[model samples]
Target: MGGQVPSKLTEKFDPHRLVMRGTQAYQPRCIALEGSVGVTTRCSIHPQRPSICREVLPSWESGEPYPQCDKARIAHGLSPLAPEDWIRFKDANASAA
Candidate 1:
């Protein structure tokens, strides 16, 4: 199990547990990328993704965007969504509703 893991990540990782839990873990080894993420954020296996993936909401409490979304955007060199962004999102949804 440990044989496939990257040298850097192997130090703290328990490959046996990873294999046992599979996709149930927060950050599964199966979906982990060896290198940096590309420009696109699309999931290749979205169609067959686990229930956990389907359950994750883009935002929390309807109007407020999730902080993790901003963190990922920042990691990809994009600006974090501001408070005004949430206001606009809520306004757009309210009109649609």
Candidate 2:
């Protein structure tokens, strides 16, 4: 997670101290602190970091290779990969595991 103060972790909650993790990625995509952008606090707000951070595949694409899948989509000069394409791309690369 993004070192946020989880409800379970801290009795007193300070949203500011909470560093937003994965889902938090949607939160403006801008960290306020100038120098410490990537550094996450010790106490995480959510036990589960955002999907983007954890690189969790979407429901449709359970075990896809994100980078390869993403690159392939871009190589064609196409838009972002759709969920179904991601699923297929991931599955095709599964044997490489």
Can you give the TM-score per candidate against the true fold? 0.37, 0.25
C-alpha RMSD in Å of predicted model 1 compared with the true structure: 9.5
**In candidate 2, which residue ranges exceed 4 Å CA deviation?**
1-47, 50-59, 62-80
Q: In candidate 1, residue 4 scores what lDDT?
A: 42
Model 2 residue pairs with clashes: 4-44, 4-45, 5-45, 6-45, 22-50, 23-50, 64-90
Evaluate all candidate structures by whole-model CA lDDT and list the values in order.
Answer: 0.52, 0.43
Tens-digit lDDT track for model 2 on 5-83? Answer: 3434222227554333232443333222233322332313224443334553333365444665465346445554467
Off by over 4 Å in 1: 1-13, 19-40, 50-56, 82-97
Local distance difference test, candidate 1: 0.52
For lDDT, the strongest prediction is 1
